[model samples]
Target: MSEETKQPVMIFHVSSEKGLNEIKKGKLRGVHFFAETCTQYLSLNSSLLNQSDIKEAAKWICSPPVRDKSDSEALWYGIEGKVLDLVSSDHAPYSFDEKGKFFMGNNPSFKEIPNGMPGLHWRLPIILNKVLRKQCNLDLHDFIRITSTMPAKIYGLYPKKGEIRIGSDADITIWNKDKKVILTDEMVVDGSKYNPYSGFELFCWPDEVLLRGHTIVKNNKIMGKQNIGKFLPTKLSDYI
Candidate 1:
């Protein structure tokens, strides 16, 4: 395509070294490296689901279906080397009943299972744990860059939303680096009844979350009023 007609594409849930290389070669505009694509790919293989139990298979049923465990390390390297742009949750929530349909033989084919798993609540802690464990070479600044700064900048909220500076929104998360929590279904704040990260121990937890200078969560408990969120605008110029 000619430069005048070529539209920007944001690749989602990249799952392999080849895919990462394609993004680099094509000079793709945006790439979102999802949590499941990073960690679940290392721990779970799609083929194993065929021999595994229902619950196990259901947990592994997300899009760009988790790749071979070996591909994960290379993807991590892409992140550490700045080849990958950002990390996202792709937080799609389906109730146990919905995800269980495939297991119940509603449709035995793996392709019939819904694509996506909940991760918004778990994204922060998982990345932080990987950093703490030396599983990834990212430091706190890199974490902030990928999770907040870069995203805000890409979506046209920079200077006003992502940074710690004068005139910026007060949105922030206060993390307790020493705290640890074993993820459980009960901990999910969204409508989803199951969490893929259930039973994983995370070394850090958000003690508070602020939105526009208002305390939305304190002591890990939600304090925001319902239906209070406002939309922020974005523009094509936000692209890097």
Candidate 2:
């Protein structure tokens, strides 16, 4: 960071108070940084530790550990205060039957299980439905800032990736703020039926997602096949 004049942003698949404090006191230097707390961090807790088999619960495990309710509450406070800046799915799917054996009979130590759950497809809706429903006093613009603009700016994609104005990439998500959907494995494309978010009722969904003049997601489903992505350089020279 001293060499580049850039403070390292932390992207924890799960939130940790200890880690947060470490960053707050570390070599961060007044350099701006953004933390993207994933869905698992915002939603799950550590009680899964008590499962009959730790391995079975392994799939639900993420790094830095899902702390207790106090940690979650602290994270909530951070978000409300603008200390935390972004939320993402961090979505990696592992099959349930594959994870069932670990938790089925023998509880393993916290380190014994595989980690990650599916939600790349449902994160935005889940946030809009659950958090926004509580009337946290955040306007739709706040939503755009955290989920879209801020991250874009930090990553050098700002004014290019996040905006709806002319000359932007035309990538836009049009939300049906009143739409509803029950989150289920059936709704995901990762081919994993095991979602920590299963049984969640999503009240806000995107009805249209456009990518560079092409529509990609419509009616709650992705319209394109996988691997349609092209590589873009993130080097400063590439943008300059």
Candidate 3:
């Protein structure tokens, strides 16, 4: 973007104060910059990277390593204030048992390990955990906006993928907000035995998920088959 021509830009999985500050400057100039942060940045910190176990530390490795608690706090503030427009999983579900954090047969260098962590299974529940704890002044609407609505609109899926409007696809998630549980890797159906959030506590999680009115997941069990979905046309969204 320049003085004359402006375009919408989105920074995915942003987790640093420096990036936020730059976006702050752009916002003052009215630039159409959108930013997204993943749930790990909101909960995890760089302290894990400093541990003695390389294998343990590598589980937390991603493109931009998780920063200090201060940066995480700033990101939470960004989410609470709408400075960060969306939250994503950026889910890289590679088991450390393989090439995820290890080389042929030995523990790999941090640079050698594939970046990104596993959390597509817990993105919603983890953020909802923060909302339940009232840590970031997050509400249910904010959750829906960042995790669901905005991403759909930004990607041109709009009222079709995000909302429950009449005639819209019945893609929905039913949540049991009062449920309490401690996380474990066995619960992950993505076939990734290692999870960075293995010990996380959650107050809410999805009870069921419907795709195009088909109940795909219910009571933590997947009932839908693969390759049953269709492609959606790519169109520029007007709501953005």
Output the lDDT of residue 215, model 3.
98
After aligning candidate 3 to the native by TM-score, how far in Å is the CA of 127 from where it should be? 0.7
Candidate 1, poorest ten consecutive residues by summed lDDT: 30-39
Q: Each candidate's lDDT (Cα)?
A: 0.71, 0.67, 0.84
| lDDT per residue as tens, model 1, 50-90 | 75465557766787777775677777777777766678877
Candidate 2 matches the true fold with a TM-score of 0.79
Model 1 compared with the native: what TM-score?
0.85
Per-residue lDDT of 91 in model 2 = 69
Flag clash pairs in model 1: none
Q: After superposition, how far is residue 207 of candidate 1 from its true place, in Å?
A: 0.7
Put down candidate 3 lDDT per residue, 1-240, tens digits, no spaces: 532567787888788988988777777788776889998888999998998878788789997889999999998888877889999998898777764457544666766888888888888888888887887888889988999999998999887888899978999899898888899877877756777888887888789999999999999899999999898886898875
| RMSD for each of the candidates | 3.7, 3.8, 1.5
Error of 2 at 158 (Å): 1.8
Give the candidate number with the greatest lDDT: 3
**Model 3, C-alpha of 134: deviation from truth (Å):** 1.1
TM-scores of all candidate predictions against the true structure: 0.85, 0.79, 0.94
